[model samples]
Target: MATCKSSSRTGLDSWQSRKSLSECLRHSLENKMFTDVTFKVGREQKCVQAHRLIVSIRSGVFEAMFYGPLAEQDEVVIPEVEHDIFEQFLRYLYTDDVTMDGASVMGLLYVSKKYDVKTLEQKCLAYLSSSMTPDNACVILEQAHVFDEQELKEKALSFILENGYGALKSSGVTDLCHECLVKIIQAEELEVDEQAVFEAVVAWSESACRKQNKDVTDENRRQVIGEVIKHVRFPLLDQKYFAKNVVPTNLLTDAEKVKILTHWICPNENVSPFNANKRTGIIRQEKIIIQRLAGLCGFGCSCSSGADHGIMFSVNQNASLQGFQLYGPYDRPTAHYDARAFITDPTTDDVIEGSSVTKSVSVAAGTTTYDVEFPRPLKLSKDKKYNLLVNINGPKSLYGKSDRSTVQDGSFVCSFFNCQKSKHSNKLNRYTDVDEGQIPGLMFLV
Candidate 1:
């Protein structure tokens, strides 16, 4: 009976076979073994040697070109594509891999598109999409549009929307089509302020004017600015800022400018509403702070504390609240540990209904920084102090510390402890001691 070495021996044999196959294929490509077709490409018309059977198996276009009526010819002229690109396409067919840089990726993408190599085309698209930046996004967008690459187009558009300020500053923004410019201007999430957005539109209109060889008349410029200006949040501009900056631009009609100015004087008048665009005002990104409490309360307790603990901060601007950050009871997770939050109008001391958001503690054995998410974005009002109350449950599991040295001026945290230890057996303990102090390390995202 013959004894088998092991299953590992079979695996090794398979690996060795694959390695040998790759080496043989590479060797064939290097030495032009069994060469069947010669491609004349590049400006200088250089010849690249390749095997018809290998390329035909990899690409449908190559299969037809190699086996069809043209198969009788030993050479093909591919003067439209560069020699390096043609060689790369051939290399991909033989080795199933391509090495491309940002500059060369676009060329390969075109070659892949022309040669009907779907896998290589997708790889090129992925590379271009990931490599997009402020400088190249507009150009990539135009190329994607021309090539009908819908996914790449969408990614480019999204990148423009998110980073429009930086992208618009790039000279390439002026080269975008009018429709692309419209989409960029209409994007509600564009991080630029309204004034910067208006200025970008002006610059784009100037480019449009130059390209069309038209005078920058009020009518022509207005036509160029056209419906795009309607998306600008003109109402958000200061009336004086509008007079000083926007009025002199001459992009607006005399009547239209008067309407905006008069609307500022009397919002209820016949003039167009400041929010004519019906825009949900741009919400600025700001970290609302409740200055940390001056002293660390030696207070450590279980999550079961009936009274909730959190800082109070006045949101000076109307904001879309994402969530709140909590500096938790440090050192380890405890079972039955749950933390919840509630919102209140501090002026009336009334709890706002439907603002309770909760989360269970995913405990680690050490101090944890918890980013407690709100159930939904809380629409906060301007100049109103809102109390964020954190109610916790569990025993000796949650603790809080206060850092007083970092005094942020805008907010304060309420301190509470079990002041009255219940005398009666039936009653639970109460946190009635109010030590209003600066509470740091707590923040809510706007």
Candidate 2:
């Protein structure tokens, strides 16, 4: 009875064999083994050789070039693509793998598109999407426009909109072509203040003038910017700021400045040529009232100066924390208070960056809720504990309701914990499950 022992190494051997096959193909391409065709690539006219069969099987363009009416020519001239980029494109056809980075990704993308390699094109797009940041957003947007990649263009545009100030301030924006610049500035949902947009455009204009060998004068800047400057909503700029800063630039003629200033005084009159419609940056979606109290819960809940007061909670769904609603003083007229608000991580005892906002808040008459919005919405993840606190000057009366362990608003399930309070320390170290909490509700964009 010769019993054969089944070996577990069979699967490992098969995997190794498949990997070796890929490596062998890659080696053949790299060594230019049995090459039948040559390509004169790049402006320098570098001659590169490759196997026709492998490329023809991988790319429709190559297949057509080798077997179609153009099959007579054994040598292909690719004057537009760089030699290294062309080599990488051939390597992908052979090995189905490519090494991409910031510098080489765009070149590879161009080659992929020219060769009609759908898989490689998708990989390039994915790389662009994942590596996209404010500094490179404008560059990506310009390249996306050049390649006519609608999805990549939209993704880059959306990223710019969300981080408009950062993206526009990036030095890469100065190199954008006229069409790409116009497309960005003309977007209605661009989430940047008109003043910032004006400054950025002016900077871009100067750069454009320098590039064109023109003097960096107001006239030359304006000429370079051309229609792109028309998108700057001058009416949205503060009248005082515009008069002091914009008027000095001489970018706008006296008549244009007067029209904008006059439109500010008489808003009903549509005198300005630029679009006065406000840019819808981030839309507020939902306001979740954590504890619904009919009237002010004046159960000795007062927030004094240099004291942190709010609730610690976690949401079951993802949402952007736009702002928080605090209770105004009881039976008090419209009052203003200098306050500092914060969203902190309870577990790490660290405040979320860009989540702290110091502003003069106006609390309306009676026991109403005052909404204190953050500079920008802070994205909140699911199942993460966060503390929302506000430290206001003086011992102002606050409002809240009985302890609520959980609140269900629409599809969001927010579970509340003890109200966190810190008197002197920067960290929120004290916790109290009191009857009334200062933070009554949270505003979110789901």
Candidate 3:
């Protein structure tokens, strides 16, 4: 006797099979096909009818409530969970998917934990981690601390460290718990300078002190900062800043203030550097060339009307030419296409033989500032006038507004029409008439 081949072994695999089955079950859920239990949730007491077997299989709390001891009851109440969250939770049980925003994740995570649903709990944690921002990291850290989620808390803390200045400036930082604030200010690695860190701490303490209805005096603020003050690297602050801005403040004692000022001005004459408490970011330079915009150019598409615009600047030292910034609207599929950057000599009006950063474009919503970096740094010479030239094939893709009235004002800005080759004639290339006063946006850093 012949047997049919196993559908599980091929296109009809377990994943697809489960997806189709889940889709059918989800449709059934909407129609209330086999729902046998009703859940009355929130203060409004909204009613949600769901299949008992589906809920029992997906959740331990529901399984025990509907099968173990209270099998006879057909109606269940969940006043602790809001109706929107509960509905999404039930929808997940039937469809195997959950949609949530930052605000709702907390409540859903709580309900998921109460129901002993590990999958939803993990998803909630991941979402919270991804959603962390400079403005929200402090508040998210507080919530993570309350939930006892070590991983989420660490991620939030890292975000605050990376965006230390912004995080500290956020209004939410004032509402952050004392321990959370301490953890942030005490971090051993912050991307911002020590002075910015100190300012942020002082701001946060002032806000927190006011929130507690405490006076904003120096001694009060010192007490508010607590152990966090020890982490501030005062010696890293500018000497003048220390004398003018920090010394006048009553936050530090005379001796403590003297110690830091002395350490900065006369390091060997005083006590040793505060190495143990000092937090510093690892030294690394991005070596990116930041280009400021002169004017946006919007050329209409025509096969015969090819034009290119560029900005000219002189390099002061022997260095590598890397990349430049471009600003344009993100409207077309051509936005994904790679543009070109080339360098040329201002005196000779010839393309620098090997000076080109190729394939430097990164695709994004092209409407904002796009930093195009070269595959490798192209070498340049000191005292040499170089033009950072760019060309985009598509029309109206590269353009900016200009308010300058005369061609003489836009001297550094140049343009060429029908000059396809890098070695195009000097006669064909002339100072662009659009806006000379417009600051050249093209900047290159070695």
Candidate 4:
């Protein structure tokens, strides 16, 4: 009984000792007690204090700097690192803890990497991953490239591609380096139209010209962009839009414009230098069949008055919405109808811009499926509810049964909710939920 009591007392003392040491170290760091080294940091050369032994013990780079054969100076100069950032780095060494947010995390990451502090570096990366958004992705990608952080670079690139429109529009895009900008424009998986890509490149060119101390003229803009402009996929741009918008600008040469026009006229001929291949995000479509219809029974939804009929659904992963598949007339072999499709954020009650497509569709005989495609792939974020509404002028069409609310296809999962309908005069101003509606499946690319 004496031996057991002694062992328990020893264990309790050890735990208390460890707790006391941690508190003492934290207090020492806070008070700058027994600090043996001084650092002149940042362009202003502000002085900061730290303990050499604690810093060396925590960081291999500091150990080498302080104890290696070249070790001599008690004072270190780091003109590139800010004073507050150095303080954060020293605090981590002393307390093994860090407080970071979006604004300070990047600086902390740079300092941690310089000092070979693996734990702090990883913590910074984890913070960045959680807080990444389209607005800052370009800036993050540029910094990741500078730091040679391959994993962070890839993550930033993926986020930019997934949210191409938002990222391109962000002011941070102009801050990207030339090589990084080229990589982004050349990516086949980028989910934005070629016109948007062109506009982003133009914006970058203007910024680059200003940095080079050159006038922001058409010639200077073209010169700054250089070879990056070749990746714009000029042939993929709409012919009318290209003629009206692109031709007016001096960015493209007469020869280049002629080549693009020739390709449009004779698409089979490889005359243009630019790639005509459609971005995979636009062409590689996958259909999520919420419910397949047999075309045996006519859908009961009223379609003659040109009322909008649709469904509300959300995707489990980031994707581009291509369009939707709706059924045609039940008995008629062929029919002509004016079809319009658009998507809206049901939460905000605002229609997503560039999502609306209107065209006259002719449903051929022997086919019940009518494909209505958007003018461009609409960007859809993961787990956000969007209403896909289509208005068709025709008679009764075939419909399907909705036995399940959720359907999983490979890496993609789509969940369907209530059907939505709106009259032509009100036209998406408001939607009334219908118990039964007629959208068969969603066409998309993940």
Highest TM-score scorer: 4
| Each prediction's whole-model lDDT (CA) | 0.65, 0.76, 0.64, 0.77
lDDT of 2: 0.76
Off by over 4 Å in 1: 1-49, 69-83, 128-142, 206-226, 238-249, 269-281, 284-445
Per-residue alpha-carbon lDDT of model 4 for 154-199, expressed as tens digits? 9999999877876887888999999999999999999777988998
Ranking by lDDT: 4, 2, 1, 3
Superposed model 4: Cα runs more than 4 Å off: 1-19, 72-74, 129-131, 286-446
| 146-253 per-residue lDDT for model 2 (tens digits) | 999999999998998877766887888997889888888888788767877898898898889999999999889878888987799888888788878888888888
Q: Estimate, for each residue in 1-446, the C-alpha lDDT of model 3 and write its tens digit.
A: 11112223446554335557778677666656556788889988888778888889999888888788657477777899999999888888888788899778988898899899999999998888888776678888888898899988888888887666557767668767778877876667765556766777778878878988999888888888887887777777777887788777777788887777666666765543343244554232124342343455544221112444556665555545556665543355444434565777766767774455545344455455656654434456665666656654433344445553212212232222122334652222233323331123433333
Tell me the lDDT of model 3 at 178: 78
Model 3: how far residue 101 lies from native, Å = 3.0
Query: What is the C-alpha local distance difference test score of candidate 3?
Result: 0.64
Model 3 residue 164 lDDT?
67
lDDT tens digits, residue span 272-303, model 1: 42344432324655555443434444555544
